[model samples]
Target chain A: MRAMVYRGPYKVRVEEKDIPAIEHPNDAIIRVTRAAICGSDLHLYHGMMPDTRVGTTFGHEFIGVVEKVGGSVHSLSPGDRVMVPFNVYCGSCYFCARGLYSNCHNVNPNATAVGGIYGYSHTTGGYDGGQAEYVRVPFADVGPSLIPDWLDDEDALLMTDALATGYFGAQLGDIVEGDTVVVFGAGPVGLFAAKSAWLMGAGRVIVIDQLEYRLEKARTFAHAETFNYNEYDDIVVEMKKTTDYLGADVVIDAVGAEADGNFLQHVTAAKLKLQGGSPIALNWAIDAVRKGGNVSVVGAYGPIFSAVKFGDAVNKGLTLRMNQCPVKRQWPRLLEHIRNGHLKPNDIVTHRIPLEHIAEGYHMFSAKLDNCIKPLIVPNAR
Target chain B: MPSTPYVSNKPKNTETREELRARIPGWGADLDPADRPSYPKERLDPSATGAHWDFPERQAGAEGREHSIEHEIVPPVFGTSVPLKGFSGAIRRHAYASYSEGRAAHWLLLILGDRVDAWESHLRSLASLRPDNPVTETGVLSERRRHGIASRFGVKRSDINHQWIDPLIVGAPWVAAGGAAVVVVRKLVRRR
Candidate 1:
């Protein structure tokens, strides 16, 4: 089988590798049809994540056909089309019992923080990702769902991570009727966060980004007010002014570790690696939300000390909610949203690169070239 | 006209179930509770979990598996993927066997093992027809062609601080390996 083998930072190439076989009775081998390059994959691509070893594949969002299943797998059979969540979790764990599948304790040896994520670094349990011709899915009964006949393959692929995460970000916000919600970053997650805010009864949605192209996407796809932070000297003041000087009722920090607004913060966190990730966006979230308001974080941050404004958050009486989205937990409502034309996740897909050209795909995405928003990998493309 | 607020008692979608079925392909396929795979689990019946014993039967072949020193016995179910092997595996086993999980030494050793495992993969790839290409794969060429240097100078790239050491980190091993290989070939030629 041909898979995307990681060589080093800023490098990945197509290489021949053995097809993954089921190691456990609960396992299934999926023949990947559609995979996506997530924004978080950039951390691994840039060597920002610890233990992102060479020869590992990087992809967490994918949908595929079940080529083979172990004897214990009964919900799915050979040839069953499925969308596997990025999480690899046991269905009956304490966390899974409470619908917190992302925190499943039984799957990862590093169960202290996060559960298993496919194709992430060893920090996320070292499971090979779906950015290949085939992948091994553990606890297949728990993580994968049959792609609804009405759902497009690309939509299912997006649901594996991006769309579900955005929706989960909004869900965490606990938005009330007529609340003003502000989202930082206009990437796929931010765009979906703004759109989901409307579904959750936010009176107004605002998206902030420095990139004009992504801001344009926020305006069109999310149908929210857009802000080019580069245009304003103080974007947080502008946010407050727009929200009638009370700050937004809720703020979503969709930009994580690699945020690039403040020079000092970006330098210490991103350049010098002094902190886990640049906390500029998160600090903005804490500062821009109204007192006693909800601040939701869906951004990926390393487990290290970030210079967050904990004092300000305490004084202002804010609720800070965040976690890795339990992707499967969001599917039921998201499926309904898709069926009703409330969301078209595939609409954000701008590029469909074959798996062979993944190196170029990573380069383009990391460089922010050619107005690429989301790039989907077709592993079986001819 | 303003859009209907989703929080209102009224259904957000005005379309009837029959209409949605007609409009969207396979729209209601899993609408039936029985058709959903998770429906049984949704009942939250503890008795239906199918586990008759207090604890699950221990999986076979747990003897050589590395477990944290904190654990008296390995957990009932643990990941078997990427089983420990090679010199890196020995380091990992030592880390697990010697130190507590809370110690930085344990984590640091594991990270070292990971780096060693990566080098092992790279050395193994060298023996294959397609050896790892340091220049293109390391993206050193992009610094020249893609304004990589210029981008670094003014940009807030987190990686820029350590850019000077990147070449040494990526190239030193390959250079050393090449020099070693040349020395071996020269000795063989001299003997001939």
Candidate 2:
């Protein structure tokens, strides 16, 4: 099998690796048809994540065909197409029982913070990712859902993480009717967050980013107001200015560790390794939302102390909600949204790179070179 | 002061929905209220938020906190917990100084620092008579008593795949530490 192997930061190569066999009865071998290089993958690619060992493949969002299944796997068989959620969780864990699949206690022996995630480094369970010709999907009964006959393969791939996570971010906001929602970051997740905010009865949606291209996507795709934070003297002040000086009712921080607005925060957190991640966007979220408002954070941050505004949050009585998206939990409503033409998850996809050229794909996305909003990987592409 | 043009019910651009649809593929798919699931809840009224201030008062105590090299000043408020310290702090400082976050060395060093910090905590705990327990902390006891082994054998468990490794990875460190302690005690006893 040909897989993308990590050779330190900013270096990945396609190398032949063994086709993984099912070591567990619930495991299934997937012949990956589509995979995506997520913005979070840039964390692994840039060596931001701890224990992202050399030779580990870096992909979590993928959909594929069931090439084989273990004896205990009854829900799927060979030749069935499935969309695998990023979480590798048991269906019956304490957390899983309550629909908190992302925090399943049984899957990851590495940490208790998050459940097993495919190819997200050893810190999230060192299971190899699907950025290859084939991948071993564990807990196949729980994680992989058969691709709906009406859904496109591209849409199914995006739903595995980006789309579902975006909706989850909005869901966390608890937006009421006519509430103003501001999203920080115009990445795929951010775009989806903005889009999902409107579906949750937000009166207005605003997306902020440094990039012009993504802001354009926010305007066109999400039909939300867009702001280039680089253009403003203080983006938070600008956020308040637009929301009647009360601040937005809800703010979502979709930009995680490598946020660009603050030079010092980015340098210390991202460059210096002082903090787990840059809290610039999250800090901005706390400041930009109205008092007693909601702040939904879906951005990927490492498990280290960030300089968050804990005092202000307490003083203002802000409801700060965050978690890794329980992708499967959001699927029912999201599937309905997609069926109703409310969301076209793949519309944000700008580039399709073959598995062989994934190194180039990572470089392009990481460098922000080609207006690449969402890049999909065709694993078996000729 | 006049409000920003963006804080209006009207679309920001002059282009109509049809025009946007023409230019961008699949645009305006959710434009109609009938098509939207939450249309009944969406009032599209942006003027109702009862806000009195032009700018909120800034929170105090943001001085002298760690910030990225890119900012001129810290945000109005920032967290003041868990300032970096100890030998692990030195390793982290070196990691920041030596390599860009884009390099694998930076993160590897950070992970190494975390391990060092864990050991430091363990040593501190030992002095406090509240030492870390490998058995309970690692959930090894749960496997014996809480149907952990029973759950993995016959049921469909992804973790069963890596069960072979769970012991060596978890137990080896403790075994090595125990052996080291035994050797030290033997030397002390021989001298006495």
Candidate 3:
């Protein structure tokens, strides 16, 4: 089977490797159809995560057909088309019972910290991801949702992560009707959050980003006001000025570890590997929102201390909420939204390439070439 | 053309598993090796408490026991007192070898377990063994909770093999759960 193997920082090549087999009773082997290179995968590509051993494959967002199921997996059968979430969870655990499936207790041995994530790294449980011809999905009954017949393959693929995470970010913001929402970052999640905010009855939405292409995407796709932080001398002041000098009602940080803006903070945190991530967008969200407003963080960051302005957040009485978006939880509504034609998740997809050319795909996405917003990999390309 | 059968010389030993093991450095002591030890079934089973043919008395081969490290997974196979919290299945598997050979009348029991760091820490504890903290003390706890510290976290005095010694409080995540170990057990129970 051909799979993407991580050689080192900034090096990925599709290589012939053994198709993963079922390691546990609840496991399922799936023949991948479509996979996507995520913004988070870039963190691992750039050597941001720890314990990321070489020879490990890096891919999490994928949709596939069930090729085999372990003895205990009664919910799925061979040839069942499924979209596997990035999370690996056992449905019977304490956290899973409470709808906190991302922090499942019976999946990753390193569960004391982060939950099991496919293909992320050793930190998220060393499960192989779906960037290959075949992938092993643990807790097969729990995380993989069968794709709806009406849903496009690309859209279903996005729901595995980007779309669901963006929806989850909006869901976290708790936007009330007619509220003004400010979102930091014009990336995929940010765009989705901005769009989802309108669905949640936000009177106005503003997206901030340095990249004109993504900001353009935010304006066209999200239908929200846009701002380039680079153009503004002070982005927070601009945000305040736009919203009657009271700041926006809700703020979302879609950018995580490698957020650009503060030179020292970025250098010390992301470049130097000092803190978990730069926390730039988080701080920006804090400053850009009205006091006592909600802040939603959906950024992918390592588990380490960041030099965040917690004092300011405290002083402003912010209701800050963040987690690895329990991907499956947001799927039902997202499925309806997709079916109703409200969201074409694939509209954000800018490039499609075969799995063999994934290293080049990673390079193109990382470089942000050809105004790429998202790139989908076709693993079963004839 | 017929191919010759490929046979290369790699040292073949006639010594018994125990005899060959004793020749290894730092053997015949109460130290347990870092990975799983290969022992015949009859020697280590708690139900078969009688000493094997190697030992003359019932408790004579007690210290020679090998402990296999098994993960006390969540949706746990055995109901244990340890709080099952985060990711629990994906773990590093290791095969350990035991070092201690001499049989003692009393066996000391030590308990230890943490979620992510338990496996590595257990090996570190095994590696850190010396005359001060003998192998008799840290025989490597298992999930069976047969008075082992890894599963239940807390070890009772009666769970010890012999007399209950003073408990040592280590500053680990396990310590917060109030899991203390009985480092010395001086009384021997006969199964014969």
Clashes of each: 3, 11, 13
Q: For candidate 1, give the lDDT.
A: 0.75
TM-score of chain A of each: 0.98, 0.99, 0.98
Candidate 1 per-residue lDDT over residues A147-178, each given as its tens digit: 99989999999999999889878777877656
Model 2 scores a C-alpha lDDT of 0.72
Candidate 2's residue-wise lDDT over B1-192, tens digit each? 454433544223234444544544334343344443322322332122111222212324445333322223432222121234678667765664566545556556767765565556555656864455544333243233334445445432222343354355435656877899999999999999
Return the lDDT, model 1, position B147. Answer: 51
Q: What share of the true interface contacts does each candidate keep?
A: 0.10, 0.02, 0.00
Measured against the true structure, the TM-scores of the candidates, in listed sequence, are 0.81, 0.70, 0.68
Candidate 2 per-residue lDDT over residues A1-382, each given as its tens digit: 9998765545577777889887666678999999999999987776567655556787999999999997767689899999999988775645665667787655554445667889887567567898999998877777888999999999999999999889788878877656788999999999998988776666678899877778889999988889887677898899877766778889999999877777677767665556778899999999998888999999999866678888988987999988898787667667887897778999999999898877677766765645679999999885
State which candidate, 1 or 3, has the greater lDDT.
Answer: 1
Query: With candidate 1 superimposed using the best TM-score fit, by how many Å does residue A302's alpha carbon deviate from the native?
Result: 1.7
Q: CA shift at A243, candidate 2, in angstroms?
A: 1.3
Is candidate 2 or 3 superior in DockQ?
2
* Stretch of 10 with least lDDT, candidate 1 chain A: A104-113
Clashes of 3: 13
DockQ (0 to 1) for model 1 = 0.14
